[model samples]
Target: MINLQWQSFSKEECAKKLRTDIAKGLSQQQAASRLRTAGPNELAKPKKKKLLVRFFAQFCDFLVIMLLTAAGISFAVSFYRHSSDYIDSIIILAIVIINAIIGVVQESRAENAIEALQKLSSPCARVVRGGKEYAVPAEKLVPGDIVILKTGNLVPADIRLTESSSLQVEESALTGESIPSSKKAETVFPPATPFSDCRNMLFS
Candidate 1:
């Protein structure tokens, strides 16, 4: 439990403090109280998007559409000209189709990559709220709550250790270590640093 007698701090303030103090030994109750808490401890959700809408957004490319229109004009001119123009019209149409196909393929693949990246960040969390267990959406998680983590669950957010009995965490996602890490509460810094040693004190 977090002995969070945080007399002066509001929940948001307290959560902010906890995020800043992830490695700085805060008690379980203190940390728990801040878990999935509101205030400064949250990242707001983005507006939900429909896949068809997103795909349509890609169609707005002026260059691709322009090429297609030009090709259509080319076909119209050839048909009005003479039967001998068939080869020229076909070539123009092929160019337009190829350009459109390339644009659609690349843009669609890029969107998929972005979606896959989002999956990497969406992790499941086990939390204790009001002395009861709750499985919640990670985006809805706030600070000032007690979170229980174990093998097979992704670390939804950053955490400070309130209690640990040989807390071993697999940090290969962040640290590039095939071997898992053992966690303990302590101060750490430069969070984005690629140096594995700096990440020793905390888990995701």
Candidate 2:
């Protein structure tokens, strides 16, 4: 596993620490082993989800149950009245079925969106991993991972940049900026300015 100890330092400081550890009569492997044994360099495990309960929960919406009960009541009323309203019964039953189908479709769509794994399918990435460079899936990324950016590519994740040579991003979704915002790596105060003036982020 790649170890990322990003706290208590800037990017340059982190790089210098890696080099200094190697220069102190310790092999790269030994330095890496020591970092791992520290147990503070790894990303925390994410929470797990219950698949079976979630799958069953999808069909238990109040809309479908209410429609079904209404249809049953309609049939019972017609029967108790000794009336021959076959057409009316069919209409009520059809409404119940249609409502059930609509609920199923809506529930499934919502579930798929919540459970789907989001990723950047960019065929190329300037990625730094295991203290070296490689091309990998954007989904595999965690915090403190460094990625190089350029035009014509969506940003892979949120980052507190320590370097940028003219970074920019389209942030209409997050800030409703109505335009692509220019970015810099400099730190800013807590919500001190409007989106028009704040230029320190790159977001999808």
Candidate 3:
């Protein structure tokens, strides 16, 4: 993992450590190598349950388990007595199966909706490589790569600003602040400083 303590270093120091030019950014070959080493810059999606597993999980609830146990016992008693009361047991089993199916359908729909929203929210980024700028999917970014940002562009990853000219960012997505925070490129803050106060760093 990349230590964010790099934020405490000067732009020149960071460039020296990352072995990239702040002015020209990383060459295409260097960016490709770093991508293999650092992996992509993307948010981790929540793990989802398989459809059959999710459907079965509904029976794991305490109330549902008890209902099943009751149904089983009722079924046994009706079988022993040879009474029409066995129809009641059948009805109970049917109700439980129907309820489980409904739960599964609802949860599957919800998961699909969440997945759609995640796809819609995927961010794109602008980066400089080999002295040329390219617009690429944000998930392809890697550490040591130089990114260019403008107003309304989402910060694709944790970044230590190398240059700033009248840069201001709305960090309410992470900090819950309602105002746009002013940014600076030259200042190095203490490592223990809170995120809301790190004017020299930008976060994804």
Candidate 4:
């Protein structure tokens, strides 16, 4: 399906651009072809770092490198002085190790939390295909599908509104505004309009 500045177009213009019938949506054959071309409607997950790699990354900070350098110099000085005490170098090394451990632990916990949230999110969306309404898996959605939005429904993709009735969407996840933004299918925004001001559109 066509991908363009949908927020700047009227509903009729959007339908024409996407090559979709607003009343009937896309045929099964068309949807299938578009799905293959677009791939699944999901964000790419970052590759997880190994625990050892993450631990080492913590030492890459400037302050950590400085502390390590200071510890090395202190050890060298102690060795030259023929002194048995290595307290200063040992303490600095211990602090750096502890900091790395804490950093690794926090990163691991955050990854687990994000995975749990992904599992809990909505997996399907209601859409019209071949003039028939179906609750299809969200990953199957293509650009031209006519999605039916309702209260509390998590939008499955970035969509242009074709119709609405007192629609007010919670966009805090995108705009950081707690207030629900009022939406209108007929409102065409100007070029370069901020996403937060695009009342005629919905985002995933």
TM per prediction? 0.48, 0.50, 0.85, 0.73
- Native-to-model Cα distance after best TM-score fit, residue 91 in candidate 4, in Å: 7.2
Q: Which is better, 1 or 2, measured by TM-score?
A: 2
In the range 1-204, model 4's lDDT, one tens digit per residue, is 344678888899889888899999999999999989988888887899988999999999999999999999999999999988899999999999999999999999998998999877747899999999999989899888999988888888899999999999999988998999999998999868888899999988
Candidates sorted on lDDT, descending: 4, 3, 1, 2
Candidate 4: which pairs clash? none
lDDT of 2 by residue, 1-204 (tens): 233423324545544654432112233354346546644322465564355554445447677566667767878888999977766668866776565566566766786676564322334445665556656455444334566677777676544456666666777777776777777665453444543444554443
lDDT of 4 at 127: 91
Taken over the whole model, the C-alpha lDDT of each candidate is: 0.57, 0.55, 0.84, 0.91
Model 3 scores worst on lDDT over the 10 consecutive residues at 1-10
Best candidate (score: lDDT): 4
20-113 per-residue lDDT for model 1 (tens digits): 3333333445544555344333456576556556555654678757766776687778777764566665776676656556766776788779
Error of 2 at 91 (Å): 6.6
The alpha-carbon root-mean-square deviation between model 2 and the true structure, to one decimal in Å, is 7.6
Q: How accurate is candidate 4 locally (lDDT)?
A: 0.91
> Candidate 2: deviation at residue 92, Å?
3.3
